[model samples]
Target: MTDALAIATDLMPVLARHAAAADAGAAFPHDSVRALREAGLFGLLVPAEYGGMDGDLADLVDVAAVLAGGCLSTAMIWAMHCQQVDAVVRHAGERLRSDLLPRIAQEGYYLASVTTEPSKGGHLLTASSALLPEDDDLLVRRDAPIVTGGEHADGFLITMRAGPDAAPSDVSLVHLHRDQVEAQVVRDWNAMGMRGTRSVGMTLSGVAASHQVIGQPGGFRAIAVDSMIPAGHLAWSACWLGTARGALDAVVALIRSRHVPSSMSRDSELLRQRLARARIDIELAGGYLALVRDEVLRRRHSGQPLDDRSLQIRIDTVKVACSELTFSAVDRLVQLGGAMIGYQRDAAVPLERHFRDLRSASLNYSNDRLVGAIGTMTLLDGAGRLP
Candidate 1:
């Protein structure tokens, strides 16, 4: 295993140990986060010169999948943080890069995204909040319906209109240190699963230096199209796969430990066949994820633009397919394990937690929206037979 994957593997027990309690209380996994920080995973995507691993998308996928097997919430937090890091490393000005990247590597500074706005919901391409000039800095007061890991983020990458009069699509990304922002929790996070994410609704008032604006004014569309969307989809898909794999492992263990009577031998065989089918689904989802990951890495290495219609369609399809496939696989595994093992909260198997968490995979990004978008893109591309 690569060093990054090994570190993530070693930390799995730590994440698993606290996952239940964290999920029970809907609390952040402090111990798990601490373990990840100490392991230097926060710098997984940072450049080597910045004291990071200098890892690529493949590394992120492997590490995220392993970590998610232990605790989906912790893995998701790390994945989202890495996504923000990618944006900063690629688009942020020299000043912001110099200030945040090193700290993120050495001090394990966690970054949070503040993109979703109340008016626009999950329509991240546009922003309703505008950045106003204040003396020597830019001031922004934005409210988001959901800010994942917001309460614990050391920094924030916020999206806003370039100015009061700028068009909604004329968005800019600004970096704000936690100290520069005053955040008020507007809604508590009480969810069915992935509760440890602490995705609370909050109103944030912050000031950022002029140099902290990443890329150019009205340039956020490019950043999202090029970086955020792909990274988020890939990482989220990995987590869903991991969650399904974890449950499958639990179900297998439960089956192995039980002794079936000869009269039920045929039933046992049927159960094994069902399990095999679920495993096949999981493998298919994983294969597709790997394929997309390699394609993305190839484009990045060759300095090829990622905005190609075909590539975008593949990325979106992978997300939709993986989320749906993994969720279905986990549901089947849960059924095979039966109610006593899968449905009981205190059962030896943890399939119940996995089932609950995986359910959110489809709803988080809303597969319907993605499917509609994919269809529109395909229809608009006259040169396309298939993407």
Candidate 2:
């Protein structure tokens, strides 16, 4: 096995053991995070100069999928954290990079994304709150309706309007340490799935140092389009794929343990068919993911702008396809498991948790809207062609 894959396989059992308790109690997987920290997974995106693994998209896909197979919440948290790292590496000022990168690499500090505001109505690109200049510092006082991992992160990448009078679309990204920001849990996190994410709404207000702003004014749009969207889409797709795999693995184990003799029953035949279908769906989605991964990395390395509207449309397609296919695979697994899949407390089968988690996949920023976005891009960009 490849070294990265081997590392992921070694960590899966540990993460799987804690997945049940974490889901049941809606608790963060502290142990899982610690394990990942020790494994250098937290530094998977940081450059080697900062003592990180210097890993690429393919590495990220494999690692994220492996972790998601064991625990979706942990995998998601990890993915978002990596996104934050990507932002800092790509755009942060030299002083901030020198100060924070090593800490992230050596200290394993998680960085959270704080961009979704209540007033934005699910549009993460716009920020209602503005960054007010206070003497030498920037004051960012705004209520983020949803800040995933806000309560647990060591720092945050906050988005805000360029100024109090700036348009909502004129947004910028800022880095703030935990001490600089006060995040109150305004909305309780009692979600149907991904409960372990503890993705609660927060009233966030912070003062960032002059050097903390990652890029130029109104630069968040470029970063979001180029780096954040691609990385997040790939990582999320990997996680969903892993979640489906985990569910399938559970069903396969159950089938093996059943020990049915001689001739196979009708139920067994149907189960086999479903299993084959699910596997095929996963493989197809994975093929697309690989294509997207290579294309994105090549574009990035070649200094080609990923700002093309068609490229974004293609990304949306990849994301929606992967998420839907993964959900389909998991649903088939649940059907194959019969009544036993509903037993939430059954330690032998964690299909309920996987089901709950995968249900949130399509709900992430609404797949329907994303498909509509692709259509809009295709129409407006001449012949509605996609990259």
Among the numbered candidates, top TM-score falls to: 1
Pairs of residues at least 3 apart in sequence or in different chains that clash in candidate 1:
none
Candidate 1 lDDT, 357-378, residue by residue in tens: 8888887877888898899888
Model 1 misplaced regions, further than 4 Å:
258-267, 382-387
lDDT of 2 by residue, 275-301 (tens): 899898899888888888888888988
Query: What's the residue-level lDDT of 152 in candidate 2?
Result: 89
- Taking all chains together, the TM-score of candidate 1 against the true structure is 0.96
Which window of 10 residues has the lowest lDDT sum in candidate 2?
258-267
Clashing pairs in 2: 378-384
